[model samples]
Target: MRKILLLPFIFLPVILFAQGQHTLMDTLRAQLEIVFKADQQYRLPLEGMAKKYGWNSHQVDSLYEGMSIRDSIDLGIVTHILDTYGWIGTDSIGPSGSTTLWVVIQHADPDVQKKYLPMMRTAVAQGRAHANELAYLEDRVALEEGRKQTYGTQFQLNKKTNKYIIAPIEDEPNVDRRRAAIGLEPLEDYARDAGIAYKLPASPPAKPAQGPDKNP
Candidate 1:
């Protein structure tokens, strides 16, 4: 979607001697924060503009080009961290740090998202990651794979209508319950922020799932 360049970038020398892994994690956390801020700088401003003037195709394209560059760079760092240390969870890097990892992966291509989905699931089970972020990533991946999303977190801008709408969701009427389980606001509520007046299906609500979706 949308993806900062903190000059004096992430190339700082990492001292891992007697300081141990904690120091290494702190450095990584700082790097993650830099990447997270960069990820937002372009997209947030563009989102504000879209809300004010509606989506301008040229502006959206320009913003995405910038975001894609940052996203690729961020993804490289995230992939290296994951490869070297496995998933750095909240316990090791704190909530914001863990979220930065998820954010990069979520913005990655579908193949990259699929590659790391299982590890993220385990991170969630261990309480090292936020379920809400997992829900968003899960919905994104599912939509890319031609499947119905679970949390209704993925939306598409209908070029014709010039509006945002939730992507297809499984058991649509019960999506709110599924979202609630993972700490996401209701779909309708989330949509409103994007200027979408979302409405649930007329069908009766289905029984809630035992937990978040079991599929990967």
Candidate 2:
């Protein structure tokens, strides 16, 4: 009988610890939900936001598929944001919308909050910047990829001359081939005049031999 009574006492601390952890996690989730919802209000989808952060679209979608906005905003996510972006000002905007939560935390925890508050701000800023840069880089890559697909390797011959040549499109290279298979002069000149930089391929396609070969 005594052992049974003592059993509850022994497990009390464990119970309390579990409860405290759960409460803290719940609180964090609630706060995060607010932030996530606010972000959505601005027309930013979580998938797009994740992509901006350099996350694969599928991975991000899977993570948030069944998660509520509240659950997604947990303490872990907040900490991640803080670690990435620097803490500069609490009132500043964040990727997930306004930094009102930071301000609230500062007001509520004052002394204790000061220690990690800067980290949170820092993470938010860094995360935002990183996402933006990734988005821009992806756009450029997609454009280049599209251009390559649209323009095949062969350059059509439009005109030809010893000193001057013109092609239907620009050919890639540096060779003595006078077949005007989209000569590089226009591209090179345009790049120079427009202050753009580009390099010609090392070898040009060989020009078709003039007339049929005698060696049937």
Candidate 3:
């Protein structure tokens, strides 16, 4: 993608140089900032609510319904930008702006995540996107596809324990090696942040029921 591409929003005038000096990049960046905040606005509150009231509470469910609406709107915006811009990255937009694109997609429905996975892989290959972010996406896509995660980045909240547990991972023992290649901390270290006391078993877990490539 070009460093600066004209973005003509359907709701607004053709983006161009103006008296206010609002260029296409400026509008795109502004949209990204709005998306970033909206993406978190419901989520941050939900996290606090989950901690205080528990996941199954009516309060948590109500907040989640609202968050789901915001997520759908954000997904539409992000997909539009991606379709128009093709994964433009930190060079064209700042880091936070670029991240907003990935963040929205990461939180999107599984089909959306799967559709954009290859594009993000290309972005990472071109150094437009972060490898670590790609790693997270890869793990999510794998899990969504009923395959074991590669980098062990995905976790599930165990309702019984009210604690998080790392999702099923392929090649459990060497997950850290894959993680290190992409600059993520070891799986155990990452699990700790979720309050999980996890360790790689001495023996590798049974090879994931044969499936598509899980290697990152």
Q: Is candidate 1 or candidate 3 better by lDDT?
A: 3
How accurate locally is residue 82 in candidate 3, as Cα lDDT from 0 to 100?
A: 96
Per-candidate TM-scores read 0.79, 0.26, 0.79
- lDDT by residue (tens digit), candidate 2, 31-57: 655755543442345546675764566
Any idea what lDDT model 3 has? 0.86
Better of 2 and 3 by TM-score: 3
Residue pairs in collision within model 1: 3-39, 4-38, 4-39
- How many clashes does each candidate structure show, in the order listed? 3, 14, 0
Candidate 3 regions exceeding 4 Å error are 1-22, 157-163, 203-216
Please, what are the lDDT tens digits per residue for candidate 3 over residues 71-166? 989999989999997998787778888889899999988889999999999998999989998888999999888899988999988889977899
lDDT of 2 at 168: 21
Off by over 4 Å in 1: 1-18, 49-62, 202-216
Candidate 1 TM-score to native: 0.79
